[model samples]
Target chain A: MAETIPLEQVLGTWVAALLTLAIFSFLYRDNPVYKIAEHMFVGVSAGYGVVITWREAVIPDLIQPLLDPAAVDLAGPNYVVLIPGALGMLMFSRFFPRYDWLSRWPIAFVMGYSSGLAIPAAIQMQLLPQLHATLQPVWPAGEVTWWMALSNLLLFVGVLCTLAYFYFSREHKGALGVASRIGIFFLMVAFGAGFGQAVMARVSLLIGRVRFLYDDWWMTLVAPWFGGG
Target chain B: MRLQIPLAITFLIGLFMAVQFFVPHEVFQYSFESLLAWVRIVGAFALVLGIGSLLRTHWDKIRRRRRDWPYSIVTIVSFLAMCVIGIGFGHEPGTVFYWVFENIQVPLDATMFSLLAFFIASAAFRTFRARSTEATLLLVAAVVVMLGRVPSALIVSFGDTAVGHYLHANMPDVSEWIMNFPTVAGKRGIIFGVALGAIATALRVILGIERSHLGGGGGGGQ
Candidate 1:
């Protein structure tokens, strides 16, 4: 019986459903319930992060193994791992103005590593791959039809003009200016498409929430059996 | 000196990471991997900063009893309550924290995400109006894609053929044409222009010629 379905289990799900509906209602208009739900989300997320840091990261990875190295019976302790962990811990000192400078070790480490990572990754992954992929046949000749050829030509033209549109040093005159303007139009279309996709993705998520509220909770509550039960 | 030192460090580390990707050195691989792991750990700390900012913003509003003060009160109360539940008994399966997270957090996030569907429909309606050649092209492609993706698209027809089938069947052909003829040529033109522009920009940045992102202005400095 103890292992069986509990009252809190039953109540929690329904309460959660109500909160879900409340937050979703904000799409129509902002209200206090939505505010409460939003705050709850933030609070829970922060608390979870802290808990995860303590349990998964700080405890086993940093504390337990380091504190009792001989007890674990490893070849030897990896003391080097402690350096960054200590630095990370010192970052909490920033909360207190007196010890704020201690935070710099960790902050500097983070900034150093991130800058190192981004520069190389950005160049190799984004810039290089894109640049390499760009150089291609000036015209479509293979299994391509007339429309396909035309579209490819348009793409080629669009890419050039778009590139031209961004060119700032040279004074755009006559043909250069006309091509640049055409390039701007293509870039705008691309941006618009990307924005549309983003909006669609977000809205689809919202719709799923609404469906759960209406079909799962509301409809279930008003079922014919509920009137007598 | 502070700025110069950090910039130098940045250049060195970035160069190391970049080289490690192509280089087959064991030490480089180990250091780079270790550096990546450290970055992920540091990223976790960023959430703490975010939480602190959220607290400060809400607390200030509450303390001042500013416009929409009641909302702040609700926010603060909810935040505190959820935090208490989460911290006190989150790991325990039957605890309030676990219950709230599974029941409340999961559902809410899911619901919020679902709202995007309605928003997309509204946005699409506004955007799909054809006023120009480009707009018409966009509308037609969008309609085809939408129809092609759905089972019901077969119901909507022109002549004997299902609009979706016709659209999908021709999509590859159309896209290939677009890609090969216009897109390829356009891309080439864009690349040439971009390459020249980038070369110029890089020269400026390296020589301290373009200093806009650096915030001060021109790169002409000591």
Candidate 2:
């Protein structure tokens, strides 16, 4: 005999749907029902983050290493991580005006280190080679079609105009002004193509979610009856 | 002392890292990896701060009964409910957290972003008129690329075999080439220039010449 479905689960499902629809109602206009859902979402997300941080980072990365020093091998048992960890904790000290300055060390370290890393890498990887590549192109290896030749020429032209778009040492005037305008048009076309690609990606994600809800979840509940003794 | 110290650190660290990149030493590589891990940890903490602010802002709105206050309440309730289910109940697939995330979050995010499609179409319709030689070229290129992208273009029967295939192959190839070769190359060039400028800026900071980021007095306080 089939088991009767529980009312609680049914109610939970309905609550979930109501909440989902409430949030979606934002597309029409902002309303109070949406605000409650948004606030609840923020609280829950924070709570989730706190839990994950404790489980994933604090417990595993920081605490575990301290508790069993020999078991942890990554950076060796220097009291260094403890210094930053203490500073991170000191950030809470900002709530008390007297001890707030203690938080500055970690903040400074974070800013200093990030800029130190990002600035250099951005120069080397993104800047230099790209500059060099723009100036040169490898000639066709063996045979060449007119189409290929035309494509290469267009590519070179596009690169030049795009580069011209950002050239602001002097005011864009005469030839420079015309070139920059052309560059912007090319950039817009590129962006339009990218925007299309982004739409396609989001569509696939929606389809995947719908499939999980309708096909996977529904089948799990219904499929057992087909093989009944 | 507050801003000056940080600024000084930025300048010195920036200079050091740039030098380290050119040097092929194991010490530099090790330092970089360890530093990278430290930065990642700090970044995660920043995310927590952002979430706290999001909760506070919404809660205050709900409390005051501000215009559109119900939306804030709804948002908070749904958020908290999901978090409890996600964290407490283990946010595995088919669970409450998963159900809400899959059903609500994914759809809402997608739909909001998808609205851009209609906006783009309307904008294109308004702007894509052929007025000049340059405009005509652009319109021609757009139509050609649009047609070439989909398989349905083959069934449109613009002509017989020859001219249509030429349009199909050539226009798309040109568009693809423009994107892959020129557009990419141009972007890369700009990126490189910015990078060099960054290196210069970082060097200036490290040496204490450029201290604008550290505040008005520069490195004098340090």
Candidate 3:
């Protein structure tokens, strides 16, 4: 079965092993092997990004509109694609120091549009939805379990106390201090849970690499050949 | 002239788009549809600009023959090689481009991120001491969650299957309850504050009060 494997796949697997080991070597110290691997990784990722952007975005959105015959019916020869196409071109003017100021025009436009777009959308999407979900009935208009009531009460009190911690306009010398203290307790619990979850995620990633080393590279390539298995 | 015009543009464009959200009319939407197309193209171009900057930095290092400049050559060569291969041939699965990405890039990235596990473990060991009440509480809560999340298979190996099952059920339930109640409550408070702050910042930028983004090069027309 190993002999029947394609040369490219075997080679790719070997290269992958080398790259993985190189990156993992950073655990010891930042050595030559790690630096080389890191730089290569950075370069390849950027290059891949460019290829993807061109293939997915540029050709399809900007070029195809003008080139495709059906685009006439869809957008009525909307040479509107050229508007951004030109702006995108202007972005490269950063390479030229004299005309670099021209780059700011596109930057301003992008920033302005983004700021405008995000402000309303953030409110509509995140702010309002989260608030609405928080404010829903504990009983939910149906069966009333103690568990449900208790959880709802916890959630409501938690939100209020948490908000009180952040409300800095009032001095925290009295009752506000008490609510804030409760808020700190709630926050610590949240942080602990979140941290635990994150640790698990990172451990899973380490397990994956170790699994690859053991199962994919060594077991497949080395162990069977040596008759160790 | 430059500062005023650009500021006006930011203000008007922001105001127009924000107003567009409220307006159900086709005219505003029609204009928006056009604006969005440009934004996508510009965003893609922004990525190219970033890549150019990265390449230029490495190219300069190589030119100057800085310490470990040989590594800069490796970066440039790898970048160009990948770029050429990707552009010359499509990046479909099983292609050389895809293979390079999956084998070389993916593994490297995953391994780098996985290194954080060791760092986190060491940090935890150092930080989990019970010097104070708050620290003790934090350490205890962290231990509980970690134990609660441990797989039942591991627990079964240590003890009885029945005990493992009991641990699995209660542990996950307790962990989830902590997340659902306290986490949501704390996170929601933070979210409201963050959202308000973001809104205020956005308003400042739109109104041209935040000219810091215009860059020290020419924001003041100096």
Candidate 4:
């Protein structure tokens, strides 16, 4: 026996299915259906962002502080918000040419703050870790084998040559040119692998849409209407 | 006042935020968290400006009778509808707003991005001509990875026993070697270069040597 489905759910599936096809219609050519779908996507996403930001961010960071100052663990009623609050307001100064410079203040803050924050984090997270990993023993503790040594040697050489390729101070001539060519090989391999993984991801996404259309839309809604289980 | 004040603010804020990294005291932690809260507040506030710009763009298109102007009506109306519903009734699961999000927005967003797969395939087809040694290497590696990702069991199920076992034994290992060694080495080299550049750029901003952020004349000062 087939279980009865709710009207709202069935209708929702129709909306989802139509919109999915509308979006995929772009693969054919630019059409009104695609354009409407694209526009609706943008608008709906923006609206969604607003509600989410309000619920998760503005309510806690802005409203809550104002509503109950003591709710904040910080000293002095979380007046710290006033600083960024004012800076944020200055972002609107871009609309007025005469005071466009006001916006620069906030821009500078974000840039400098972000740049500063990113530096140490990048060094700690990316540079140091990669360097450290590269410096590990060519052979693992248990695997005292030639293949392991060879792989480790290759990794170290690959990294150095790749770095040499990017070092623009000296022209790539003689040994440097050879190293740079090898660097290209490593980079191509990396890019190729990344691309292959990306294809798998995209195929999986398509599979998702197909599954939704089949199991959810066809079996539940369309089949029921057609008097098929 | 404009140049000096902005640069000083950047230097101080940047230095303070960076310095917080070394400070381990709970008091400093509280201060850091407070500062992060301020950043989040500013970010949230910035979203309003983003939405405003989006609305203004669509509204202008509609007003000017631009190409596909009628579609702007769809955007504006959908935006307004969602906004009114979401803001007024709230986004709880049972609400109309939530239903719209689940049914309409979710599918649209997912399907829209999913279209990139076709574009990637087309791009790959065009680029993988094997005209050069580098291109050949890239194409070969891509093929290996693609084939390797398909499980041997699946391949066997499709009735290719000899190739299936061969791939099952070696393909995955080969793919892993490509990723774990060559790819990682290339990526790490890039990361090192980027990290150094970032640190250098940050220092320049702090020292007031890089003022492009302030706009007009690269923010080289008034």
Candidate 5:
């Protein structure tokens, strides 16, 4: 007996294949089929986001605690959860013209909390660590290769020049102008490398999609006709 | 009263959150976790508002019979169907919702982004002109990095000779050197500037100097 594929699975493969091709059709030019696919993509993405948010955030954080506190390892009916629940409900005030201003409370709370949190985070995570990494000694206390010293010198100078380029408080004349020009060179190289990486990633994704269409979709369609499982 | 209260709330919450970073007390730590939970809950509501706005826009388009109005119906229907199936059946594997996500959403998302490969190449072809010295350097770097990234490019045989072996051994090293040194330097400079700017902006927001988030039309009262 030959193996058999389920009806739903076959249908799903066709649906996926068609959608993939529909998106690819944009390469020729925009058309109704592409428009339909684009619109469907937007709808599906938005719907997916809503469902995930509700299940992951709202249900576990807000609703579950209220309904069955024990389910979430709470010792008692956690009334504290109601604070966020009420704040969330307050967000609906935007729907009404009279109470719309009330929505600002929750918005303000979120914004204030995040902004406050970001201050120490930016300093601790980005500023201190990056500065420490950049300011390393070119020639350490031990034996070092000339190439290592040269590489360190280039990095230190490149960073200083880049910073000089960003310093717009003073006019770029003479020494500053030279540093700025060097800075621009470093920036351009970094940007080019980034662009190359991005192009590679996109190309890899394209290859994966093409492989799926060829290996999965096409094979499923033609395998039965070829007397293969 | 409306404006003042929110501003005060913002300042107090912002200060507390920022200050809690330095505090090692268990109470502060507990409060920090609780506040973060509140933020998540509130953020979910914000997403609801966004989705509501999206639906309203499509609904209006269909009602007005705007250009490509029929397409709006497709969006609305697909959105509702996904929501109904997802919320009703749950998103676990073997469910209808999972099937829709795997077949419909994943393919659409991947194919849509993969199309960018062609678009980016076309864009680069048009804009990557070597008009200036900096532009030439960028172009050269991009080409080198692109070729160097592929292992096969490193193995280019010049009649299967010694030169080919040297090139094969050194190409990846040169690429890695550029990325590790010059790239790191440039990125560190950028990060320093961004971090300073972020701290300043956060402070301004916490102090209520940045009242733009409170919305427009004379709510800028101190």
Candidate 6:
């Protein structure tokens, strides 16, 4: 007896392969096939976003707590959810000419809350930690290797020079000019490393698509004829 | 009244969010959590507004019979179909919605991003000219990091040879050092500036000085 491949698996592989090829068609030139795939992508993504948001945020956080018996019992029937829900609905006011300004209220609330929440977080998470790390003693009270000490010294100076480069208040001339020049070198290296990492990530994704096309799509189609699974 | 009320709401909400961080009281904690939940609910509603805008744009395009208008039909149909399937049938595993997402959306999304690999390579070829010292450093660093990140066996074919063995041992270490030290320094400097700028802008927003979010000349009057 021979094993059978499921119809759903076969159909899915075909669809995925075709879509992958459709996207890859752009590498040749912009064409209708690619445009169709792109439009489908946009539509599917938007629909998926709505579904996920409704399920994860609105239902569990807002609707269930408001209406569901089990959820109401757990959270004690909170009516505060109405405020944000109303604010959210108010966002649709942008569609109406007379009520367009009403949209600004929710915008203001979100912006204000986010901005306020960010201030202390920025100070605590980014500023203080970075400052402390940069300001560390190059020659600590322990037996430090020459390379370790050199690395620390370079880091401290590099950070200061980079900061100087960004300091547009003072004109870059004399010592400041030299420091900023060095800062540019460090920045370039950092950017290059970042670009390299990004390229590697994209390449990995490309490889994944290629593997899917070959292993899942091609193999599934041809393997049955070739007496392979 | 409209402008003043929104501005007042902004100030009060912003102040409360900021001040609540310092207050460890149970009431403040509870209120903070509730406020966060409200943010999430509001954000979900905002997503609906976005979808509505998308639908309107596509509908207009189709109605006008604009260039590529047929594609708009595809988008609108797919959007509605997915939404119906997802909402009506539920999006859990084994459902048609989940299958569509797994087969259609996932493949489309992955392939779209994977296409960037080719574009980025093309871009690098065009822009990575080593015309100056900084450019040379960038080119060198990029090449070194790219090569170093790959598996040692792949890059160093003659791993049994002395030079190849040395490279295999040290290439990753060198890449690690570059990322750990210079990258950290450069990124930290940038972060410091950004953090300070963000704090200043947030304070401005909280104080009603940054009224650009209000739209239309950012005037106080409606």
TM-score of each: 0.71, 0.72, 0.90, 0.92, 0.92, 0.93
**Alpha-carbon lDDT, every model:** 0.59, 0.60, 0.82, 0.83, 0.87, 0.88
After aligning candidate 3 to the native by TM-score, how far in Å is the CA of B144 from where it should be?
2.6
Per-residue lDDT tens digits for candidate 4, residues B1-222, read 878888988898788778878888888787777767777777876788899999999999999999999998988898889889988888899999999999999899778768888998888888788888888878888877776776664476646677667777788778888888888888877888998998898889987899877874332337
Interface DockQ per candidate: 0.27, 0.30, 0.62, 0.62, 0.68, 0.68
Question: What is candidate 4's lDDT per residue for A43-160, written digit by digit as tens?
Answer: 8888899888887777778777866766655344666677888998988877777777777777777776786687679878988888899999887788478987898999999999
Docking class of 5: medium
Clashing pairs in 6: none
Candidate 6 residues A144-189, lDDT tens each?
Answer: 9888889899889889999999989889999999999999888998
**Candidate 2's C-alpha lDDT?**
0.60
Per-residue lDDT, model 3, residue A5, is 73
Residue B64 in candidate 2, Cα distance off native in Å: 2.3
> Distance (Å) between predicted and true CA of A212, model 1?
2.3
DockQ of 1: 0.27
Write one digit per residue (lDDT tens) for candidate 2, span B96-200.
Answer: 666656555554455444444445556778887788655665565555445545534654666567777777667666656555754464455456567777767
Q: Over the true interface residues, superposed, what is the Cα RMSD of model 1?
A: 6.2
By summed lDDT, which 10 consecutive residues of candidate 1 chain B come out lowest? B213-222
Tens-place lDDT digits, model 1, residues A37-72 = 776766666666666665555555555556866654
Task: TM-score winner between 3 and 6, please give it.
Answer: 6
lDDT of 1 at B116: 60
True lDDT of residue B191, candidate 6? 93
Indicate whether candidate 3 or candidate 4 has the larger TM-score.
4
Which pairs clash in the backbone of model 4?
A: none
Write the number of the candidate with greater DockQ, choosing between 3 and 6. Answer: 6
Model 5 lDDT tens row, B151-183: 466456364667767776676777788889887
Give the clash total for candidate 1: 50
lDDT of 1 by residue, B93-137 (tens): 777767777787787677666666667778788767789766765
